[model samples]
Target: MADNATLKAQYLTQVEADLERNTKEKDRIATDLAALQEQLAVLEEDHALLVGVRQTLVGQAEAAAVTPAEVPVAAPAEAPVETPAEAPAAVVPRARKPRTAARKPKAAAPKKAKAAKAGVAEGGSAATAPTLVELVTAHLTGGAEPRSAAEIGTTLTQAHPDRKIQTTVVRNTLEALVAKGQALRSRQGRSVYYSAPEKVTASA
Candidate 1:
């Protein structure tokens, strides 16, 4: 009876060990699966970027290959197209609106509105809506030297205390002043400054 009991106990011990080993194997497999999924995601992103680069290179090559007569011209062609259809087709592309040259790197519009929306400052519309005359009046009223658009924008908030100022507004005001001959632009190094025009006395 005692011998039978000992054999049974050993069998139970072996079963528990097997269960623990199986659990560890499952955990390892799960870890490996997670790693593979992450690798696949990275590979997909890399593939997309590579595809874009390849497409750009392909476009460059195609652009290079065409002879002047067969070439895709941006605006005016020197020679009459061989086929009227082709000329029209070229015109078609233009008609469809060729993207204008990359628009002067458009300094992000120096976005005062977006800054306001993002809570960078207050008086969003009020700052932008001020007319050129009004802005100049306000600028002068603050006892500020006629400052360039940049300098005015950089430090004008301290004086106004009620508006978020932008370089565009200052520039618009300066241009208006220049047009009226009320202010002159001065350049100190690369920086431009403005001061009320040298009080020009109109000739009698």
Candidate 2:
């Protein structure tokens, strides 16, 4: 009977110890599970935030694609309208009927004054100015001997300082007079000399 009691006490003590160890292990696993759950909640919050940002960016891009940019359209150019050829005659008679007869005498007065001024100016200049051809002929006639083109040109240029007489023009006029038989041209060697027809006859 005493051996049976001792064995029963030993088994009861061992069962209590095992029960305490199982309770401590259960508490430790609960703490570990709580930490893991907290970490998972943080990850889920970060995922939700990233997904919201992505959706907002995608929405903006879709909106931009749907809406087009505005462009200004140009106005069309208008073509010019042409009047008929007979339209001027119809318009002129209506516009100028009252003023036509009244304005004619007034317009004619200024035209007559202009014509008088022009006539006086022309007549005065014509009476005073001797022609270049007449001057050249008179110079050749007055000269005693046959003159070279250069000598005649120099004398005429000196006598009339106001005149712009070129030697080439003088030579051309002498040739024309020679052709018309009004002046005589003689050549001594390569030098050409000119005189009036009467002078040439006297010299001969």
Cα RMSD for candidates in order: 25.8, 47.5
| C-alpha TM-scores of all predictions | 0.34, 0.46
Per-candidate count of clashing residue pairs (backbone under 3 Å): 0, 0
Q: In candidate 1, what are the lDDT values of residues 1-204, reduced to their tens digit?
A: 999999999999999999999999999999999999977876775455346445545654687776564535633542332244344445544555322322312333345347547664465645766653565655654534556567666666665667767766566556555545666655444355666554322320
User: Residue 96 of model 1: what lDDT?
Assistant: 50
Give model 2's TM-score versus the native structure.
Answer: 0.46
The lDDT values for all models are 0.59, 0.73
lDDT of 2 by residue, 1-204 (tens): 999999999999999999999999999999999999977876775455346445545655787876653211111211111123234445674776644444545666677689779989998999798876688899989998898878999999999999988876677677667756888877654466889988874433
**Which residue pairs clash within candidate 2?**
none
Worst ten-residue run, lDDT, model 1? 98-107
On the 0 to 100 scale, the lDDT of residue 101 in model 2 is 47
Candidate 1 Cα deviation (angstroms), residue 135 = 31
